[model samples]
Target: MRVFGMQHIGFTVPHLEEAVRFFEAAFGAVTCLETGRIEADDAFMQRRLGVPAGCRIENIKVLRIGNGTNLELFQYSGEEDGEEPLKRNSQSGGFHLAFEVDDCHSAADRLRQAGVDVLEGPTFVDAGAMQGLTWLYLRAPWGQFLELVSMNGALGYERAGGPKQWSPVTGE
Candidate 1:
């Protein structure tokens, strides 16, 4: 089976307010949803995912980071049991998540000025079709690796620089 597209990327945070504020300052994302109960909304996810009963799930905020893509943040009550956020090489294997930006340099500057750790970049990625593309990596306040790509390139299920072409196969 072929996968369609990414629905959303989820992150578990200790505090919702702080995470929300950081994202707002860094990416200009606005709060789209704030819910307290995961179980009430989806009992299957709650039960199957091992989300404890009565867990204080707050501020399931969705930010429109790119075209038809969203960044979903979840703030669970109490301390985080997982590895510390922002430690790129920590026990948590997941390295980073990227967002498309109009201008990577400006975005990096904004993030740096806002006290977010600008790890690297605003550098070029020579991906053949698109040269001189700029991108940078930053550590979100919650320690998640956020990549800002500054290039006018199409992504996901669509070809870069032009319309997509589909091919059909014949059954023998």
Candidate 2:
């Protein structure tokens, strides 16, 4: 079978409750499922999650933002070890999750006012129809990378005789 769109994006955090608060306060995300301690070191954990033996995955939470995407956030505390947390987008395997915003500059200001470390804001493009697009990158308190993009009006493809990008609104 062919794959559709994304179902969710999962990541483990140092603090589960704090991450929940951040998602709620920052992106207006609501909790869909709140799981209690899930201590397991058996085959289920090892086979399904690769959570090796002598380890425990206690607190787990799931949050949903706009669109149909879900963020599966987990807090790990156990004997099995993992690498230390790194800065936002610090390595080749690092990536940032982006969200669509109505306005870039204003959102950047709002994030700055919220005490988030603003990496860059309103990095506009100087090209064809993409001139209207604006992007901003910001970092969470826990060092997770996030990006903001505003896609409106006609873009480069549309101007170049190409079809517009698929969106929930236009459904093109």
Candidate 3:
């Protein structure tokens, strides 16, 4: 079976409100849905993925930015005080999420001005057909990696290196 593109990314947070605010301010994500009573099985899906169950599952909020993907945030009711999750740059299971921007440098600057901790710059990268394109990495509020890439073409089908050539073949 062939795999399609990503649908959404989930993150477990101690405070859903704070997480939502952070994302809204940092990435201009808009709240799409907020529910306090998600099914137990649905909540357990996150636990099945290795999230500790000590925290009490309370609410879930979904936010969407642009038309690419959605961010799912969950908040537990009685989570014990513990160490914060490691930063995206650090060794972690899910590293980070990338957002294509019109101007990486301006995006980084805007994020910094808005009080978000931007790790690196709108540095240039040789992305094949997208040669001389600029890209930058930023740390999200919950230690997740958010990348901003600026290029001249579309998101995934950018003709950076050169034009893609297709050849037709006959099925036997």
Candidate 4:
């Protein structure tokens, strides 16, 4: 057996309201569900969630962005909470969620106008396998890395009859 498709991607944030608001404004994310505070004074937090005992989960929310995976936003409070800064791309386990757009340049401009921290270009790939692709990186209000990408027509591989990559734009 094998996995079918991504159900959701979850990440803990320092502030749930700020995160939800940022996602909604930035990506037009829709809030699908929310939960009240969840806390336990025993090993449940440790055994089930691998967190320190007596930790409290302040809130949880699920958001739908475009047609991609549902985003699970979590806010927790405990001794270990906020102990580390957000990781950069150069660090291990560093990752960013990419949103496919029809026009990378326009999207990046809009993001910049909205006061989002956009980094550098919607860089164009002029050669190699990624030719015809454009991408830009930006940071969410809570420091999560995000990307905007666009593929102009077909890429080098797709032009050669390679398997088309799945996209929210094409739903392939």
Cα error, candidate 2, residue 144 (Å): 0.8
Report the Cα lDDT for residue 170, model 3: 14
The candidate 4 region of ten consecutive residues with least summed lDDT is 77-86
Q: Residue 114: error of model 2 in Å?
A: 1.1
lDDT of 4 by residue, 1-172 (tens): 8997888999988899999999999889999999979857657788888887767888999999998789999898765755687889999988899988889899988999999999999899988888899999999988899999998688988887788888888766
Q: Give the local distance difference test score of model 1.
A: 0.65
lDDT of 3 at 29: 88
* Model 2 bad stretches (over 4 Å): 79-83, 87-90, 128-130, 161-172
**lDDT computed for candidate 4:** 0.89
Ranking by lDDT: 4, 2, 3, 1
Q: For candidate 2, write residues 18-75 as lDDT tens digits.
A: 8889889888999898788885657877898887675667777888887656899988
Using all chains and alpha carbons, the TM-scores for the candidates as numbered come to: 0.68, 0.85, 0.72, 0.93
Best candidate (score: lDDT): 4
Indicate which candidate wins on TM-score: 4
- Cα lDDT computed for each candidate against the true fold: 0.65, 0.78, 0.69, 0.89
Candidate 3, which segments miss by more than 4 Å at Cα? 1-4, 39-54, 78-81, 90-92, 127-130, 154-172
Q: Model 2: how far is 73 from its true place, Å? A: 0.7
